[model samples]
Target: MLFASDLDQTLIYSHRSLTPSSKADPILPVERLDNRDVSFMTQNALKLLQELSGQILFVPVTTRTILQYSRVNLQGYGICPRYAVTSNGGTVIQEGCEDKAWKEQVLAGNVNCADVRDLLSKFREISHPSWVLKESDKLADDLFYYCIVDREKMPYSELDDFALWAGKLRWTLSIQGRKLYLIPYHVSKKSAILYLQEKEGLSTLAAAGDSLLDLELLQQADAAFAPSHGELFLQYQMGVFTAKRINNQGIQFTRTSGIGAAEEILRHVLKMLD
Candidate 1:
């Protein structure tokens, strides 16, 4: 069996996502950058994760580049996953080394999409300094790019039109929090998980995530979960999003939100395994 999970906002959370009710829970920092904690998990969640990792092939899948993913130190908390999917599945790592074959495959899959340079140029043309933060534009390992924007000032109509334009070019536009991402159609967590499943000869798969990017991953899993927070949950709650079912079961959601949601997700996964 294999369990693939998205890191940010699904398993680990930033300080801002923690609710007032969860502030009192014992939490441990899982990600640190420049002497500051960037992400964390509750103590109980950590324990459940440690137990889960021991019983299955746990894979941490994320849109983060390899360097950014390194900031998360699961080994320090007694949970070390042998395989990880990074760069939104554009890169896969095995035992701390990049799988060159997988990298080449992802690159080959993206050959038909618009070049990263072209996408960057187009973004610069359409974006304004007032909404897009200065010096916040970033290219992720040459596979995709994003910008931090002032959400309140964001022009929804322009964004919607841009999304349609990008979609025509085989690129996807996703907005999560203050970050807006433009990624290729081929680079996805679902594809990478499938690759891992075949390589490891895993029979059963379970997944958890909380964004539009994770839609395919969750849809493909035998059993899947999403926290009752983040993009997907909010859209579902507002009836704007409908999740596709797998074997007649749609993605399950945790009852709680914030840090408490992390514990709930882990417990559910553990129960499914049991």
Candidate 2:
């Protein structure tokens, strides 16, 4: 089996970073080790991950920049996903290698290269706000599209405005963490999964995530898992309705109990497989 999981608040806690805050409560323990900040992970979940590492192909599907994502050392946890997909499917990496095919596909799909830049620039100018911060060049060697303002600087309302403006260009905006991304409608996590399918000849996959950007990926998977927080607020504010809403969002559980959630989902998956 091929398994893809998201990082950030899904697999990592906000406090585990060099900076800790109130948001760390539900997911991290108050007890601090000497100088090391700890994040929460269920023991059972970790055990399952260790087991899965041997029997299945594990992939990390996260919105983190390649740089930030690399900082995570999964090796110490006794798990290593040989194939990691990041930048919200903008790049697919071999655990310890570099490749550019993913970026190339993105460029070929564009009939008007300059058009994307122009649209993003215009959106910035028209909707720029004091709250909107840097609009970094999302372009990379093998990236399919660009992203806009970093999340911390972007206010919710302005992001909403940007999304509306993007609609005019037939583009889509997905907010993951503090980053607001501008991607082509045709470019998506599903497309990346399809590419993996072609290359690996995999027949089934399991995916996990916790934001609006993850919805398509979740829907495309043979089995899926969604964390208990984050973008669920936006989903509800938009009056979106789904069959289930656990923990006040899609799934509800203690953040500190991440392993428990992972185990629960995995057990269900294993049962289906059996």
* Highest lDDT against the true fold, candidate: 1
Q: Which parts of model 1 are misplaced by more than 4 Å?
A: none
Count of clashes, each model: 0, 7
Model 2: residues >4 Å from true position, as ranges?
16-40, 112-114, 127-129, 133-165, 176-178, 233-238, 241-260, 270-274
On residues 16-78, what C-alpha lDDT tens digit does candidate 2 reach at each position? 342344333333332233456555554555666677667777787876667756766667777
On TM-score, the leading prediction is 1
Would you list the C-alpha lDDT of every candidate in the order shown?
0.89, 0.61
Candidate 1, residue 224: Cα displacement in angstroms equals: 0.9
Using Cα atoms with residue i matched to residue i, what is each candidate's TM-score against the true structure?
A: 0.96, 0.72
